[model samples]
Target: MPTETEREESWLTRDELEDVRGRVPMLYVIAVPVRVGEAGDLDQVGLLLRASDTGRMERELVAGRVLYHERIRDALVRHLEKDLGPMALPRIPVSPQPLTVAEFFPTPGVTPYHDPRQHAVALVFAVPVHGDCAPQQDALELAWLTPSEAASTDVEAEMAGGHAVLLRQVLAHLGQTL
Candidate 1:
């Protein structure tokens, strides 16, 4: 994880970011890290809790922007480490392509996913983590829920920005469903 100063030096400022966002859709990668048991069954789904701009707690996936010089795999690894801590051993899929793509719009009603900051095109994947996980930085906690529990109405309601939809999609991709 880079410091604020380092991030500032490497990335664009708010105004410059706005200009870029206006020109084209930004690329992003989202990871739904999971925990599988010895039998190769998904035992838990990792959910990240972070404080949103509205000062409320919102559930989200492990996600971040794709850097100019970075590949999708690198971006996925970067975000997983940034949010889940360095100790988390993320098992990235062999394929470079994502299981699904989520188009996030700036307007509330434009899509299932909404990001008021920018129009983000996100490639979403489900990763399996084998080691310790400590939610870092802005994340409040890392909650692991069973597939059924995660699909429950309570969990869905807690997730913001249409991540619940993405969550269900991941489960469906894994051959499980609500």
Candidate 2:
């Protein structure tokens, strides 16, 4: 019998993952965590600053691939903790429905989202997070910005891979205007 780690390891190697990416669209979940005020209005938006493939700094949301047979909720929790640290205490939504969907095509201009590595379909959520958030893994830092700051031209220009569009969509979904 294989352990959970063993089972995960047996799922796919690097070459196999590339092959699968080429053959099918990968599943992804993206989280836009926010802080709410006492009146239930949005307070701050969280964004991660990370190094991209080109070694340039870029802003991004909390995102990760959903493993085979894994539940979406579990994947969301895993990715939230992976990027936001354990003490971040993300408030997972009661409903499984996403705020929006972002389809990333390999070719640029096909959509608002683009992923040069693979074609990915991401279910995006606007998560309300309590507790302090610390950047984890390869993330350089986490920036907490006001709705206006997040939608600012400087901030939008700093984001790569269409995350700016996604951020705008998230803000709009949250009833915040740029």
Candidate 3:
């Protein structure tokens, strides 16, 4: 186990992160928490309403950067707890194969996803959560929508940073097409 000091040291400083972003695409893990029915059918999708860096409120998924020396599953758990509170018991799959890989470019139209801050390559997963969920961190609220509702244009328009696109991909992966 790493000490707290060592863990802190593993994270990049603001300047260092900026420099690194300019030089290479940052790797990220994006977990889409879902509720499955008794038969293992997709029930609802979880989304977080939070204030972005620009101070605008937007809907987003459970996502965060993979820290140095951290496993992708660890990052997913960390981020899920960060936004969804500690009670959100996420069942991470044994396989790390993502439902899809989303490449977010700094420039728009380069891909389905766009991140103006940096080029981010995200491994996306649909994690089934089986515990109480309370919005935490910067999250203002948590919304659970059915697959059809999640795929609606109105909901997509409310999402930022290409999270809506990622959500749609998750829906498709579950055999629930818009």
Model 3 / residue 80 / CA error / Å? 0.6
Best by TM-score: 2
Task: State the C-alpha lDDT per candidate.
Answer: 0.90, 0.91, 0.90
Which lDDT tens digits does candidate 3 get at residues 48-162?
A: 9888898988889989999888888889999999999999999996656788999999999998799988999999999999999999988999999999988899888889878
TM-score between candidate 1 and the true structure: 0.91
Candidate 3 structure, TM-score to reference? 0.92
Per-residue CA lDDT of model 2 for 12-62, tens digit only, reads: 889999999998999999999899999999999999999888898889999
**Candidate 1 structure quality by residue, lDDT tens digits, 47-165:** 99988888988888999999887888889989999999999999886566689999999999888999888899999999999889999999999999999988889888988888999
Q: Please, what's the RMSD in Å of model 3?
A: 3.6
Lowest lDDT block of 10, candidate 2: 2-11
Q: Which candidate number maximizes lDDT?
A: 2
Task: Name the regions of candidate 2 deviating beyond 4 angstroms.
Answer: 1-11
Model 1 scores worst on lDDT over the 10 consecutive residues at 1-10
